[model samples]
Target chain A: MHDGILTIDLDAIVANWRQLAARVAPSVCAAVVKANAYGLGMVPVSQALWRAGCANFFVATTDEGLLLREALPQARIVVLGGVRPGREQGFVEAGLWPSLFSLDAIERWLVATAASGTSAPCVINLNSGMTRLGMSPQELQRFIESADAERLDVKIFMSHLACADEPGHPLNQQQLTQYSQLVPAVKARWPEVVLSFANSSGIFLGQEFHFDLARPGAAMYGVNPTPALPNPMRPVVSLRLPVIQYRTITEPSWVGYSATVQVQAGQRLAVVLGGYADGLLRRLSNRGEGELAGHRVPIIGRVSMDATIFDVSAIPEAQLPPIGEAWVDMLSPVLDVNLVAEHMNTIGYEVLTNLGSRYHRNYVGGAS
Target chain B: MHDGILTIDLDAIVANWRQLAARVAPSVCAAVVKANAYGLGMVPVSQALWRAGCANFFVATTDEGLLLREALPQARIVVLGGVRPGREQGFVEAGLWPSLFSLDAIERWLVATAASGTSAPCVINLNSGMTRLGMSPQELQRFIESADAERLDVKIFMSHLACADEPGHPLNQQQLTQYSQLVPAVKARWPEVVLSFANSSGIFLGQEFHFDLARPGAAMYGVNPTPALPNPMRPVVSLRLPVIQYRTITEPSWVGYSATVQVQAGQRLAVVLGGYADGLLRRLSNRGEGELAGHRVPIIGRVSMDATIFDVSAIPEAQLPPIGEAWVDMLSPVLDVNLVAEHMNTIGYEVLTNLGSRYHRNYVGGAS
Candidate 1:
């Protein structure tokens, strides 16, 4: 196996989910399994989460919702992207709830429900401050005032937090205030409507933010919810790349593409079989570090398409194993995902999601 | 489909390969189909290239070489990563050529060959300038002097270019000089040894760089080969993402996570169903632009896992299609791969290889 090994700890994922669930007790914690459960394989992550007592799941599209429905038959799978006009039957038949973002989508779902002669439970996504998705305040008000609200089976009234990651951001308070105001108005018409406003970061804000359900995606996948504070979540993935070859330069030499790094004479360099194509970002060329035994080795030069060279001169001679027999940990408990993200000038979410399919993925410690 | 549509023009790929092949005529133009053909699906891309009369294929690892061998039984598949000790049987059985980069690998292959009583052809990779992989100058000299050189079935003497993209880089000339020197030395012992050098950019460096074979990967995938000159290759990929939702904010509001972009009252935003997880880098949060009905729209705020909000205020309201019916061209003739790379502060190769699997891939116009 020349490909890197991506070991995913499902047990750690479950523990993280449980921790988040415990944080917001009495409020249901829904797992966001969109983007293939943040590129950690949706089926396995969702199964593990479901086993940890997660009853509600959120996916980006109806297609993902369908896949999740097949994986978790009893869990309530909600498509956050909502229903397309012609493709409503898939969501309806599969018992997948579409988070209707606009009045047009609401009307389309209503028509589909009427055609099927069966009303499907759905969430009404209200836009508080984030202008990306959901219905505007005017549109929401109009929907609540109209008789269309009476015809639809609305189970949840949800709104996404724009600046939830930042606890002190004014937009969070603004969104929270708008959502708090809208929930009562929604409940006035539909008293049984469940309110779900908090996300991963929002759950850390306060108990007031946690209403009926808390949706956490990144935290469960081992991404730091609180950027300013230390991460409370356990590490879930460790990437181990094999050393394809090692070379010693007796003269001054350049390494990798663009001739970026210059190596001193008699310096040992190990070429690992993992690069940008394996989701090791090109930005991590000279910045990234890998762990060999207990010592850290700095990655030298530009990251190639399928290889990255690391300066292993700091390690003792006896510690260095033969090329194929040795491996370097790109991501581990010590070299955490957050640090990798920092090195790449991005977030942990990008690091985890960009992890390519070339790795030999091993999902360890699920229900078994 | 809610997922983004990835349209791969195989005819364009063939045209690009033909162009590269034409550039290095009389010399073998092998296709580097490693990293799953730079994340464009290896099987389809290799098949298309094979149909275009590409007889030689280069892959990163033995596993990839095996897969390519299965795809094109008669084609010469060279594993650039070489054999991993005990895994030599698979390569020998599959008739895959392993490019030995080190003396350790050479010794292992010799043992595997002697045990099996089969002398499989292999390539000796020499380190001319880039010390990332292959045998160093000293190691190559020692190997040539050793008695083991007489027993090996070495077919090709290859060296990779370090700064081939930069035509005027001193390292290019240095590498060429070193490789030129090594070629004659290798041919002195083994008169039948074939010399292979020159990548996609190296083909443009001059005819001198193109020895016996030119291995091009990125240019065939529509990445700019000669950065200083106009690209001779045709565009092979176009990505179109659906508009999941659209909203007109009537108040001062934030868009996407982190409240990165503050929108003025009555600003229109379209949430497209593609984000960082879909290989759209998070660095492109507020910098990236997409085309909607020939109008360029700037992406506002942070790019989420499954969605990106595009500021579509410039686009005429009459031209805007219904929410789900509308689509934006993320990568097209106008929004080329190189342009996206610039937006993400990376190279076109990184952009192409980082392309995720969630997109509904459509391959069009192959050899009929």
Candidate 2:
């Protein structure tokens, strides 16, 4: 972040973690820093959670595990996708635990560990219902038979919930039952290994889902895991862009690409330097609203590569800040990260991770 | 891109440029490689165009120009937003030609150039109508009086059209007239400087919009510069994802986040690893369609952050590919990038640029 464009509240992140952590009471809380902490700068985000007493961390790939290790050298880092061929050594070198999803992966890890003369740190991923990236019950049993789980240094046995976000969904109960049945089997084979199943949403699915560790990602960054309940999270990321130029378009002046919008009579249009390339979703171009000195400014034209035009005439007191000044005194009330996700017809994860790298990012709290 | 993830055809890119260059006929074609060649890899995209005889390239900011210079070492790189305070020195160090917009930026560039004991490379940007960036006609006159345009090493005098995409829109004519007036003024000051105007959309506005150089961005990547005409360009990028698992869903088996989708009796569902985080709009999950073994497959559920479920029950001969294998036997219909842009409520630029680093990108075509 080189422009002082966005200020991320790390305290908000810690507070959101505390709120989610409180719900799981006695269960240990883990931070999911996968996808660059959902695109909010993972190192800083995880450091904040670590200070807030987060002991465990989960990441999707080996690269992510390496990043987390660099940040939290003492924390237990679990690689969610397990070790792939040619990558087991990287995991070992980084002191990262690989999530074993297949018999082949386990066998490969065992071979790599033997080759390196090192005890392989491992986690077992069981497929409860989401038939993706996890070992099936049959596969797990076959693995246990072929290779002794007791011999391997397994750290955690985990399963993901497909419908944990929706508490009313029946599959959550079915997945809970299926995953729980495998837990005893896993524990019997490897009694020393801890168990973790819940993600951000699953952590909210009551104590049953919170086995031993709760891995919270989005909720820790302020998305409501339980939408039905009042949101316990405060927004952690605040995006702001500098107002490049301001112009009052009398009646006929048009704005932006394809002439998607026309300035009405007596409208003051403020052109912003940030555009879709800057991660201001083009769909939100004309449909969205921003702020200028607390005055709500309507985005009035098609967003271009590096510029968006907003109508500021409505705000009588709104003075266009100089070119370098951030127009958003705070986060735009009309812009929600989730809403941008929805507007892009994508999930919040995509919206977060896809955020442009051009913005000058500032963290208010945390390890920074 | 590994496993047929996403293929970028350099041929299509060069072909698009050649076609646009042909449309501009005698006008020298300049390519807009800003925003990292509209989110396609800038180095490769610009190199291809440069090989195809494009002499000029445009970027949004000075920083972009500085980085792009490493790729096209000898190419004439133009920084469209001009020199901001604290950035002009770096611009000079990188050998960038800045499009001078404001009086302050002009003065600063001159001062920096004098201080560095170098002739400053510059371009005069006249604000014909789009008040976003560039100097006004009045400012142009003032600039000529204040600065030594002859000694400034001005390369191109240009203006941007606000509504070139809409050829019928009168603003084009107004901007064209305003810009035409400044061309003479600019010529009077520096007759040797080349003239450039017309972005991707403006090129389609006929010969009038074209000058000594035409800078086209989206058109080079296959977006329709002229929406009224049949598309003369081919898409440069294609995204493909592997089907991780295929499962038999008994009546009412839930799929994906929130269990929003329920498989009916005898339905078959294939889970895909690519999701919104991979840059596929989540709305494309259940609402979009793909082709499996030449048979249409409708997506079956809400798109998860990392997975999507597709209804492959209709494809009778469908056999689930092993995990990590590209479901190439199932080819999605050739969807237009523009339509995908529309679906994502953004232009193709965002959709392409937002593509995550996780994707393995493969480029096909000649060095040009």
Candidate 3:
């Protein structure tokens, strides 16, 4: 607690939301606060977006929805994963809608609702093209006549896009065609329902996938939902750990676990707190670089579980801060989570979400 | 809590420790409990080793040492990162021994001890070949003559190997020669101190690198410290999540965000609770496979923030579990953390340690 720190930028997050919302036309833009808002701390993100006039929210599970419902209180919350068996009571009790994908789920919902005498919103997740979740066109037809849909509690019908991140991928267009065909069928069956699609990436696919409502997840957390865009989203989370010690390593000395690095001559080493356990991927051991005093310091030696050794000697003009100096104070600083993700062969989403809980979290920007 | 789960096998861990310990002879074995025992839950691992007669433990930070000391009470705990500039007093006050790497560190420790009117146990960490930390041959000589060394209580002297994991890397022999030379010098300077050198990889590098103590970290957590071994160590952790929904997709139907995948004709999709936020790297979305009812179900579509889609059509012979049924119950009956690690382009260590706390962690295996 005395050393490790994670500083999150909420203002950047709000700006990202506004930017994403601006990209979609006419359709209502909802923030996907699932996976703890891609691991940037969900409560703060949702509240910030809510103040920014964002209305709807989505989470992965009923549990996730429950948490958001408790926090936002006034926002419309949807559970991306349809309600599970025996979990419908909690969902209805909490007023959280489930993304119903299967006929069995629809039947279970009817039975639960009939038994509990509680009615809640439902979204039919239709399988447009990607073979992961959602109902087929035939299943959707069957679901319309199913006991659950006949009772008429459905509010939204939706499907997911699989390749929106790759703008040129052919699957996107094929999925769009399939999804468009299903829309009319769904509407004919349930004339009073709204349509929802378009995750963070889909929101960038223009207004076609936007439908009545658009749900954007990663974009809210500052991931460039549209990878092909000239300018992607700005980073919202800044990982900052303190420098535990700075030592001068002369030639022929090893650093870290296997002592896997060599200092050619007179070089300085800055040992920083937060290792793989703090979500600093071990893959970054020899391949990673961080900014120290605005200069890039290549990580030297094997990344230990709780600390990493950086070669600060090359940054001649950079001044190494005293021990326990925050990452922001380091002379050569590596503050971007996206770069850390790049070094680890992952996206910024993993870096932000897997961030361990040991760090002292401080949320900045936006309304507190 | 009903869905996300991780089961850790302590017996697998202890068995791994013994296997690695057997590889070394005439040398005392020490466990690296750093980074929460490589993210396998520290207290559980350390206690298992203590019962197995392991007496030495190594950690990276003073705070880690303090925590281990409370559970260990009597084990010889060593701080591997040495002492930070201003925190030596706390280490001494807590009766912790630090591995001293630099002249500045030794001097600082002397000053701190002198100011506190108490002597601290400090181990000298020499830079034999890895140039990340430790003293140069010249600095080592100067420290031997310095009054700081004479005044402070030096516990052990050691160096680290850089390429022990590679087994045949030339740096190992070079480090051996350099460390052999420094050993005599260090002994002459401080005759009554213990010595350490071999790490998890070094312990398998014959008896040359093994000094009085050998520190093993990854091996203690069930990773094959020697990746080339014909018979590797058993893995200790297995990750499982519930199947939130099972949906049918007809031809040309897409699933998941961005529409990255499409169903050909008939496909059964299972939406899982675990996603990137649960440390399931997104890259595994279309490339990875999870076991379901003895069938290998290829993950379809893009990995969502909190859900993933897997094609379960291949296992038509097997009946799918209803929604909310444990994914573990639906699996072909087994899962491997190492396999998931491979899909993530990392070692099992990263996957284990980076496991988010959102999981309901269940520690299995009886106490040794």
Q: For all candidates, state DockQ relative to the true structure.
A: 0.80, 0.36, 0.48
Cα lDDT, model 1, residue B132: 74
Model 3 Cα shift for residue A278 (angstroms): 3.1
Error of 3 at B354 (Å): 2.9
Better of 1 and 3 by lDDT: 1
Candidate 1 chain A weakest ten by summed lDDT: A129-138
Clashes of each: 0, 7, 37
User: B57-137 in candidate 3: lDDT tens per residue?
Assistant: 888777788888889888888888777767777787777888877666777888888888887678888766665456767
Docking quality level of the chain pair in candidate 2: acceptable
Model 1 residue A237 CA deviation in Å: 0.6
Interface RMSD of every candidate? 1.4, 3.4, 3.4
Deviation in angstroms for A358 in model 3? 3.7
TM-score result, candidate 3: 0.88
TM-score of 1: 0.98
- For all predictions, the C-alpha RMSD in Å is 1.3, 3.9, 3.6
Q: Please, what are the lDDT tens digits per residue for candidate 1 over residues A1-368?
A: 55689999999999999999999998889999898998899999999888888899999877788888888889988889888767899988899999988888888899998989998579999888877788877788889999888898899999999888889898888898888888778999888888999989999999999999999999998999999999999999999999888776688888889988798988988888889998999998999999986789999999888899999999877889876679999999999999999999988999999998888999899893
Please rank every candidate by lDDT, starting with the best: 1, 3, 2
Give the per-residue lDDT of model 1 (tens digit) for B314-348: 77778898866788999999899988988988889
